[model samples]
Target: MTSLIIGVLLVVGGAMVGIALDRSLLRRWIRNRDPRRHHPAPETRAASSRRRSARHAIEDAERRVESAEAGQLSAETAASRVEASLDALQAGLVLCDRNGRVVAQNTAATQFLQARHGEALVAPVIKDLLEQARSGELVTTRVELHAEPRRSYEVRAGPVERGGEMLGAVALVHDITEHDRIESVRRDFVANVSHELKTPIGALSLLADSLAADSDPEVAAHLAGRMQIEIQRVANTIDDLLTLAMLEDESGRPGARVDVGAVVAAAVDRISETAEQNDVKVVLSNRTAATAIRGSRLHLESAVFNLLDNAVKFSESGGRVDVVVEADQQALTVSVTDEGIGIPATEQSRIFERFYRVDRARSRSTGGTGLGLAIVRHVALNHGGDVSVTSREGFGAKFTVTLPLDSGD
Candidate 1:
């Protein structure tokens, strides 16, 4: 009986020990799996905390990547919008590196390249230009291009910088052909005016000195007459100058609506004396009645008289000079036809230029100041019109002045 009791006690003790070890193992498993579970050992708890922190950090990094991608897309969209806006401008634009290599260019730059014989668009013709610009050289120059129809351009180059560091260069090209032409015309006008004024002044001075020195009444009288002629020439030149100045002034001045019939009649009457003196017959062809033009009376009369006078002076003796004034709803045309020693083709283009004469000797003999046609041109232009001439050498000449009818009328 004592041996049996010892065996049972031993069995019960073994079962209790086994059950307690299984419970400790289950608690350890729960601590490892559950994040909120605590450990009795400090080292084990710190290791678990480190693992949890590492996992959280990994997840945060993934979220940051997604946000960065979204921001990157927004930035790219804004850049695209900026590029599109620049492309719509009319002016040509180019962005280049400091070495003159093209980075970007607009559509106008492409068109300019194609127009200039397939030259590389946005590329520098000379690398020195880029280098100078990078060095802060603000240079401007006029360049003539041999493109289709030809062109004149003003090119200006300057440096582009950011944050005090040299970035690159920019070149701006502007078409200045019309401006150049206007400047050329201005220079020519000044030179011509100087020449015209000097001639009459010199002639008057010489004639006056001769008259003062000549004691013989016949010689003095002849010199005085020559001086008077020079004075008249000077006066005529001054009047033409003043008239041209007035016409060129941008100020709008009121003028009378003179009857076209009266203007023609007056012009005919004024030129009849000159025609008789030159032995040329004047013929009038009035096609339209009640024809009127809006212009200063003096200007219209002077322009018409100049045309008739030119016809009479150039015509041969007994040659017929025809004057016609006609009008339609749109415009009025005044034509003066003369059978004369017609102007040469080469000289016709320059006849209307101030002080330009086809035949200087003939012009002097006919007492022409060389400003009549010029005056006619200015008057026509001021009245929103134009004058044209057609002449065949040794045949005849026809001058036509066309003026637009008043819009309100």
Candidate 2:
């Protein structure tokens, strides 16, 4: 019995140790699973749940931050593209606030501002123009800039308004120096034409009165012949003027396709008699074979005839005039070279201008209306080409007419 009791006590002690070890393991697992339980009583099961929810909320916020960063990057890229495109435009652009302060500017605007840098406090001109624009009075004025080179600009300023409230002003500038010069020249040409026409008409009128009053046969005959020549001159000038006007008008009209070779041949034929009378010969360097250009047939023929006539008139007795037609892939070049009293270098540039002559007395004696070269130039330009002259004081002159082979239109 004593041995049995000892064995039983030993078994009970082993079971108690096993139970304590199991409880210790369970506590350790609970502690590892939930570290918040180590806090005071305030951190209960509900508090643990709240902490878990807070962690999830923080993770959601982090995800939103990453998404927002991506969106910001896209917006920045779009803005950069817009800015780059705006910079590429040729027009000047400026952004200003309601107070007429320049807030933003493009490359064109910056360059324009720099050009006007010498004006009163550089900023004041812009401010004043903007202020004037805001007052409902759009200012359109021409401003001259003296930079490395002189330039004329037409500056236009207008208001930018929203809901009847003045926001700012936008200014646009155009370089019109060349345009202005052309307009000036056009005005002078009109005046010159009026004066030229008046002289012939007045002379014809005076001669007609004299012939009507005079009963002498010889005097009347002389005056009538002179009047007839003047009338013919007037008619020729009017015809040339009309031809030039038609050439300068809109294209795609009737008689647009002109056989350039035929026109040249016809001009040579028409001037054959005159060439013989002046003892001048017409020599054609036939290289084009035959090519057609888009121009008024009559005008083209007249242009060629004018060139040939001028050559024959200016050539010396028994001088040979060469007419060369050089046609290439891109352009057709018609050059009329004459061995005559060549034009001076200083007068070459203005020879093509209407009523412009190197020697007025000589041009009048030659019976030239001074519109032949001008008409030729107009025809060349209308056909998308240009006319150039190279001459020395003693050496002969070469007048080249370059016309595009193909009309891209």
Candidate 3:
């Protein structure tokens, strides 16, 4: 019985040892199969690091793309704004590269250069100026173009430098035609004034010498009368000149409300004596008596009086002078017509010029100042009105003054 019990104990111990070894092997296999093990493999760690690095690179590339698009948009906006500003300038502007090639030009530049082959004429001047300007100097040239309008152009150019380095050149073009025209007018006016004043002074000197030498009472009386006439002529001429100078100023214009009908009537009353002496009959037609306009009453009276005086002086004896006052929504017109020798077509345009006379002999005989028409023209212009004449030689003449209607009315 003892021997069998020993044998049984030994077999049981062997089976228990085998079962423990199998359980340990199953635990190791479970740990190896699970990827969440405490210690990961080297290859798994390396793969995880690579995936993270690739994801970060893609995010950086996306950010760069967005930034690049934004930069491009900003640059385009800035370029468009620069172009607009350059085009807005009134003076002609041309920008050239370092090689003197035209890189940019404004609308005014195109118009100025293309006006009647102006480009062909001015291109050579521009090239020369740019070449000179490359020496870091401001260069200028003026070209006189004898085109239909006879214009003059001045081109001024200079090198454009940044940080002491010349980059290119910029040019400005100006139209100086009007400036030259004004200078010419000034010269002519000075010459005309000198000649006009010298004539009366020479006559006065001759008449004075004759009066002093004469002894007979009848001859002395005649000489004295002639001297008085010349003196009066000089006085009249001086007065007209003074008036012209005053009229050039803004203060000489109309500054108050005036009645068209009353102004016309007053003018007629002032020239009544002169009209009688000339044996001319003046008939007044007051159609716009109720109309009112803004201007100086004194100036209006003077303007109307001069017009009427001009008509009566030019009319033949028994000839009638017609003065009509009419108005519309836009303007008021005062027309003076005379049954007199009409102005020649060729001479009519120059009638309003100061000291201009169509018939010098007639003007001298009638004691008329040649400045009458000029005064009329100035008055009309100062009052924001215009004066016009219509006539045929030897038939009749009509002077019409059109004054703008006040906007406040």
Candidate 4:
């Protein structure tokens, strides 16, 4: 009976121990499968999630850093291009910020700062224009500065705006000195041409009427001669007007080589008859020189001819006129010296002007067109040369022409 009782107790104990072990294993499996049932599993999962999140945050930060670097490079490139574009403009350009303060300027814009009197005239006006632009008013103005050489400038500026917001202002300055000069010359030319033409035309009309009305042979002959003279004067005036206009319109550079010595000789020949009629003697000197220059042959001949003719007509009887040609390494010079009625000092400044004459009565009597010296000036300018006169009243006058030495070979 004791052995039986001991066996039953052993079986019961073994079965109980097996049930407890299985229950413990099942509870562990449930906890591992379901995160809510086990707190330690949830903690492990949370640690892994935090690590992933940290890695993702690091990647996102790297992407943002790269984007910022690219944006900076793009901005720098755009700024460089803007600077280059602004500097290339021919007209002066001034750039201002929204506050109307000058932030950037081009090389040409700096010239306004360097100028003496021009700055005073230009800066204040520009500032005013800019301020006006800030008020949304577009302004354009031309300012004439009476400086040493005299200058004219056109300024155009206005506000730059987008989306109803004023961004800044832009100013453009253009130098118009040459244009103003051309306009002044044109006005003077038209006035002079009309005055000169009307006088000759009126004289011709009166002389013709007198010739027609007179019946006496002697009177008729005198009237006819006078009419002829008046007609010639009219023809000369028209011819001169045409010539001056042609010269004014000529802008092409002379490409042909011209022998200045040859030109002088030709001019002397053309004026020799007139010189002899006036009892004036023309003497040539220094003709055997290498006086060659790049010039228009026709224009040069005309200039020399006019000079010689003027010298002859202004000279008194038995006076000697000298024609000199000289050449050196740097220049070719031609001088016409006349021992005749000379120009007064006060008239020197206006000597080269068109239709200007020191002795109006004498010029008219001699059939002078009053455009000879002006023609000479135009020809000199065309050839990149200059002409000057040295004279004193009642003394001889010397007219000198200088041309840069250019190889005509």
Candidate 5:
């Protein structure tokens, strides 16, 4: 019985040691799972759940960090591309802070600002625009820059806003110099057309009334002759206007290659009567025999005839007019030289303008419509070429019309 009691006590002691060892292992597992928990204690299921939540929170934070880095890289790349695109624009673009200081400018903006206006002029103008924009007022104005070649720019400034708050102002500058020049030309042309048409129409009306009222045959004949001259002048003007309109048409066919020398000869023949009447001798030198240029035969003939007619009209009685057809590798040139009261240097640049005459009285007496040289210039330009003149005030004038040769030339 004593040996049985001792064995039973030993078995109870072994069971108690086993229970302690299990508790120690549970505390060790809790400590290993969550090292932040310093107190050694057996883990409950709630503690294990909290540890799992902490691990998930750490992993989520790492994922967000990676996502944020990617977003930052994308944003930077997008900003870089936006900046590059802005730099490529032909118009000047400038961004300013609310304080009216220049925040950013593209390469075109810098060069255009320097080339367009003086700093003294542009800086103050930009500052005022920025001030206006900062006040939430959209600003627009035209600034005329006085440079070597005068330029006109349209400036527009507006506030840049985000989330209903004004960030800064962006200003765009566009070069409108060509546009303004064209508008001015259009206005002048309208005025000139009105004046030119009125003069001939008025004369015709006066001459017609006089002829109808006159009973004397001699007086009636004189009035009729004057009326005919005025009518012819009006007709010439209309024909020239039509020719110029046709030449400027975009859909007009590329003209066929024609013998330029033959065209010159025909042009001289067409005006031979007028040359004889004016007592001016026309001398034609056709050095280039089969020289050809790309243009309409009728149009080319008209251009050459106009030049020859002008020479004959302006030349002195019995003065000589020379027509020379020459060619080079690239082009065929027809030069008309005449011994006439030549054009002044200051006036030479403007002589090609339509209805422009050096001597209005002489133009009227010679029955000139003042569109001859202008026609020649436009015709040459349309044929992929140009026309130029060299003249001195007292000396004679030489007009050169150069037409581009065909590719096979």
Candidate 6:
């Protein structure tokens, strides 16, 4: 009985141990299928946190890549726009390194900076300005470029800096050739006006004194007539000056549409009495009936009248002055050809200048103010045309005024 009882106890003990082993194996298999069960609660929480952090890190990396791409695109667009704006500017622009070497320049820089024929646009003035800029100085200067046609430029240069660090220098160049020319013209005009007025005023004063002192009525009358002629010349000069001043104004009248033929006829009519007095024949030849140009009628008439008057005044007795009007696609041309003592080739270029006279004595005798051709030139220029002359000394002369034709004409 004792042996059987011991055997039963051993069997029961072995069965309990087998049951514990099976339970532990089953727990291990469950832990292998789902790793969360393999560790303590704190360790499982830490692993879950690590997984979340890795996923967030991947999303952040993707966002950074996207942001970088956007920034790069925006930068490229901005750079392109800046380059295009720089190219469209008319003023010359130049960029230089801190060492004063050229890095970039616009097309106008080549023209206004005197960079023709492989010459450097960074002139001595520019170099000096760059040096000053690199030293943190803002500079502005008017520098004339050494070039043909003699251009004047206003240059402005300054430092290109960021965060107190200098990158290089930049310069802007503005052409002032037209302004200089106008200023010169204004000075010359004042001087010429003063000189011309003095001549007439002095002559008038002297003649009036002589008339007052003379006892004979005949001598007084001759002196008075001479004064009248001088007074007329003075009046004409003032009128021409006023016209030129009006033309120079920016708000001046553009002009009116007028028939070239009618202007020629009126001009000829105005000079008829003078022509007869000089014994010069005046003939009008119209090659085109439809010669039309847009311009001030009074100015046009004055131009033609001056030409005819000049021709008649210079012509010898019985010489013929022919007014020929012709037209082509580009222009309506009125040419006044005269048989007169012609202008020398050397003097021809300067004859159109205000107050310039080739033969001062002859001009005085004929009461020429020396501003007729000058007036004609300005009138033609205002009308979008020009005046040119062809002459051979002692042979004859032709003064041609060309006005641009209206599109329909």
Count of clashing residue pairs in every prediction: 0, 0, 2, 0, 0, 0
Residues 196-301, candidate 2, lDDT per residue (tens digit)? 6887899899999999899999999999998988888788878878876777785643436777878888888999999999999999876876468777777677
Best by TM-score: 5
Q: Which 10 successive residues of model 6 have the least lDDT summed?
A: 1-10
Candidate 5's TM-score:
0.76
**Which digits, one per residue and each the tens of the lDDT, describe model 4 over residues 1-409?**
2221111223474564222334555666777899565455877889999999999999999999999999999999999998888788867788788898998778777777456666557777777788888888889999898766678899888998999999999888888888886787678767867877788788888877887887889998888788788788878888877887888898966789888888888889989998999899999887546887888888898998899989998888999999999877777889999998888988897788888778988988899988998889888888878999999889989999888886455
RMSD of each: 8.2, 7.1, 7.8, 8.3, 7.2, 6.7
What residue runs in model 5 are displaced by over 4 Å at the alpha carbon? 1-73, 115-120, 145-147, 162-164, 250-255, 339-341, 344-350
Which digits, one per residue and each the tens of the lDDT, describe model 5 over residues 330-365? 888999999999999878877888778899899878
Residue-by-residue lDDT tens digits, candidate 6, 37-102: 665599778998999999999999999999999999999999888878888888888899878788
lDDT of 4 at 22: 48
Candidate 4, superposed: residue stretches over 4 Å from native: 1-81, 84-90, 113-118, 241-259, 276-281, 292-298, 314-320, 338-365, 377-398, 403-406
Candidate 2 collision pairs: none
Better of 1 and 6 by TM-score: 6
Worst 10 residues of 2 by lDDT: 1-10
Q: Which parts of model 2 are misplaced by more than 4 Å? A: 1-78, 81-85, 88-105, 109-151, 155-172, 250-259, 275-281, 287-297, 314-320, 328-332, 341-365, 381-386, 403-409
User: What's model 4's TM-score?
Assistant: 0.70
In the range 277-391, model 1's lDDT, one tens digit per residue, is: 8888988888987477677778878888899988999899989899998988888888999999998988887788777788878887777877889889888887788999999
lDDT of 2: 0.78
Q: TM-score for every candidate vs. truth? A: 0.68, 0.67, 0.69, 0.70, 0.76, 0.73
Q: Which stretches of candidate 1 lie over 4 Å from their true place?
A: 1-94, 103-111, 116-136, 145-151, 253-255, 315-319, 341-353, 356-365, 392-396, 406-408
lDDT (10s digit) by residue, model 3, range 233-299? 8888788888877787765445577787888899999999999998999999988644688877777
Better candidate by lDDT, 3 or 6: 6
Enumerate residue pairs that collide in model 6. Answer: none
